[model samples]
Target: MTDEPLADLALSRSSLDRVALERRRSEVLSELLEDPRTRVAEIRGDRMQVVDPGDRAAPTAPGAPSAAKASGQDASRACSAGALGLVLRAPQPEDRERLVLHLGRDGDGTAYVGVVSPGPHEDPAQPGWLTLRQAGEALTRRDAGLFTTGLALANWHATHRFCPRCGAPTEPTEGGWVRRCEREGSDHYPRTDPAVIMSVVDPDDRLLLGRGAHWPEGRFSVLAGFVEPGESFEAAVAREVAEEVGITIDAARYLGNQPWPFPSSVMIGFAATTRQTELTVDPVEMAEARWVTRGEYRDLLREGTVRTPSGISIAKRIIEHWLGDTVESVTGGTSPRW
Candidate 1:
């Protein structure tokens, strides 16, 4: 069905709750897992890369055959979604010479097998790890971004196996969805940190942007920061703009958001309209802040003006929306960006 995601082998995406995923026995899941005709795929970068779903030997990750002895192959592959989690989705080394296997923990506990290999475009793990492009494809090219969701959920669950309140251990349940603390009877749900992603626009329709102190050379993006506890989203927006640029936002227009699963965050997107256009730079937070006119921003985007945020990030979406916003709706009947 064309209902699949953008078919990105490497993009950050959320997961689809397989509502109809019949709860099968471990044997059935195993049997169906490697079936040749199982219309399935693997999540990478937030996108899905199709792999052959047939019961065949897939490719091997860095430590093949003996996944136990691969030097520095101990799980935490590179942290989580955004934290450098390094998970290898290598297939078997024998048989089907062309099939692919995912790097999954086997049932026997003594061996690690490729269990998630599905669809057709899956790589052979010839190099043992997915490349940056492949990672991006997996994150964005797929339908509904599953790779990021799966990996993020899995990573958080893996790291939080212990309870904080009681110092007791927890176990994975509900197909790795729920964590029930054994000692405290506490049920911990997945956590998604809240962040303010705003497009601070001046009356002249120029969008405000800044370069962070630690960003790469010539790299710049919209202002964004995490929202602290007990603070309203709008308050966070006003405070952030003031703190970062010395401007105050009078109104906030809610924009859509994207689930940034890089270790679990829900970016709250907004377009903050401010009449005051004074420049205030926080040496500790940003190197500089500037206002760009609609015409100027158009040129900037056309000529690669400043470093923009990732396409998958809400910051980018908010910017895109304002860039094309109707002149009248953009606060003062003025064009916003150049």
Candidate 2:
């Protein structure tokens, strides 16, 4: 197995400075909004505005040259040929009425904020608006971070408007990072559920793969499950493998992790080894489970028989770690998506 950590897990990349201390200042958001140097990323539903590097039709808001510079748009033409970038503009007056999130700052010290619309204000089928899954692999590192952080914050705020302890309405504070209950004044922060995704290998060097219940045929990826309360990640890995595939893993090694903000999750990855590989599958969680050697896996990809996980997923990176090469390198083409 490769000793090096998995490289370039999508959604894990970020160039932003997160200036977490700035979130504590009461005047920070006001000051940033007053200055046109602050760039605003608007989030509507699960989508954000994305634009091609060469597309000049989307004009920057007034006094936004600094905003554009901070967003790396000036140098984006030299980026990957078909790469997309976030559409950042000067803050609007209505942003104060919406859910405003103090995202972070770029290396240039220019701040970025996210304004969440109550609903999809624009047409969902519009060409420029895209969810993170659709545009993550194509966006620059900074934009990916902005979108992931913004979406996660937005989803949290949407679901957590009321305090659990007092059953009281909460108001956003701490630059939108914390919500305080109106009655009890208790603070609530964003929550990230931890899930373990693993590549389970048997003694013969075969990798275990399973298709989730109700997943389409030919769609398979490694086993994964939420980390139960009071359980370590390694323990969760072993338990999930056993519960899903009826196999007891002897040992599990840390691989890597990535922010998976599909409604809010951080996927912790692992590589597990097992001596027992009996074919007993759980019907509730998984439809099928099988072990495949590297050669067999490659052949399945070449024949388009098995669909891989999403390109922006830690599962894909974990699979590549076990395969010793990218799926594209094996298939010599774009991977068949699940």
Candidate 3:
């Protein structure tokens, strides 16, 4: 593939400056929350509210200044029409009781924080509330980074409420970046599991695709699996291909990586070449496996015989890399949701 494909991976684009040293300041979260200049993104479940960039009052609290006003920019000129931005507001008094994360700072030194609610949004059916999968492709680089980081941290806090060493409850500290054990005094940080997703190719330049054991019939994407203990990404790639499809790859090349926080994982991508062309599918892991040439895959997509992966996924980009054109170019429609 080329650098353009790797650069276009949706979840990999982030412009926030994660001032790590600032996260260490005592009472920093409190200070930022008190400042009206700080920008706060509210997350409920996996969704955050989105607004058209051209809308001036929609993204702010009832009485507070909008993000553009706080940052000294003209809201009308902030972005083109039809583009989306996060609904950031001035922090509320109740935010102190919720899980607040210090996302990062913009280039202008304006702080950004995320406050997560305990349950789903009050009105999920409301027009603007959307999850990362639905909004990531449309959001600005900074908002995308904020949403991705905030959701990943919130997921970690949700599942790691107790200390692994002594079974004690943990409390958030260090701007919600670390959790300290109430009993043992041990500190825990956020966790991200690493998985490898790869496009496997045979000598004939045919791309390998598979449907998961539980996936519906028409949906298919590249094979992916978690990296095991004491294994490199390349080794994981080879093992995943061998275990899932019974093919040994001769070589593997790194393409790129992106955060996939469906639960919690960072997906590393690779392209592998193999000489074997045989049929052996692991029934427990895959429902079906097949090799498709560039022409055949295009026909499958154009005919609506196969569904592509989610638009925000690296799997889609990897498949696009192997196919040498986008699925939309062949199908004349947006990528289908899986």
Candidate 4:
């Protein structure tokens, strides 16, 4: 729980275990989206059907909760009016799997989900109330990001009700995969943005950290920026390092990626080494940059002295790698409060 990104919250399903949208739209529509112990209703707008406290399982059964599908007046509409925007998170592995949800249509007919998974790594309960009376506010950002995938799919149906190129409205086809444009001229589908974040490790195995001027006092995290077109990920990493820290990165290696949905950003993690050079910081990108020692970092984690990224992120991973064994015993193994 070292304020770094903890990406493995939900199991990372491989293609073998994945259920694709185009191929299994029927399975999704027919099967309950949530566990059988919970309730399922149409998730339009940004609301979710909350399970009554009495309906929730006791503390013993941590993962046995089910979502029973509803069929009443409350059945047709999304519960609690949706909160986060639906995101199309598709992992194109050796085999590809995509998840879609219904989102509301913009006035211009564009579909949007309010938030994405790999975003700021904020707390689920951190935002504003959905309904005016605050009667049904139960979705966590973690779950909201998950449920929004479905909501975005829904909104895709309403607005994509046409084709952009031919001015022909599209209809749901292949369960919910392709929206066949009215004229069969050209059908348009949903789109996702690609962004990269890196966790650079120097020759000494110390993580390279930088703090944007706007971040919290004493809080520092990894260097990250969007990947521009026409450049490779390695190039982006080098360019970003140069722009932010004025240093050249040596070897750039891929680690993993997390879905960040503050409007859909994929956090690409990496490990890289930098050549010895004078430290320089870009005022726009970072205020300070340094290679913190393990001993120095241990104090931050144990005493909770330094402001760091929330424990649920990549920055924490880099630091954990930085602190190694010392962090293992911090906080009496209570998941290390980041």
By lDDT, the best candidate is 2
- Candidate order, TM-score descending: 2, 3, 1, 4
Quick one: ranking by lDDT, best first? 2, 3, 1, 4
Q: Tell me each candidate's TM-score.
A: 0.62, 0.92, 0.92, 0.57
The Cα error of candidate 2 at residue 217, in Å, is: 0.3
TM-score of 3: 0.92
- Computed on alpha carbons, the lDDT of every model, listed in order, comes to 0.52, 0.84, 0.83, 0.48
Q: Report backbone clashes per prediction.
A: 55, 0, 0, 55
CA lDDT for candidate 3 = 0.83
Off by over 4 Å in 1: 1-15, 18-144, 301-305, 325-338
Tell how far residue 142 is off in model 2, in angstroms.
0.9
Better of 1 and 3 by TM-score: 3
Instruction: Provide the global lDDT of candidate 4 against the true structure.
Output: 0.48
The number of clashing residue pairs in model 3 is: 0
Q: Candidate 2, overall lDDT?
A: 0.84
- Give every collision pair in model 2: none
Which regions in candidate 2 have their CA more than 4 angstroms from the true location?
60-82
Residue 216 of model 4, lDDT score: 64
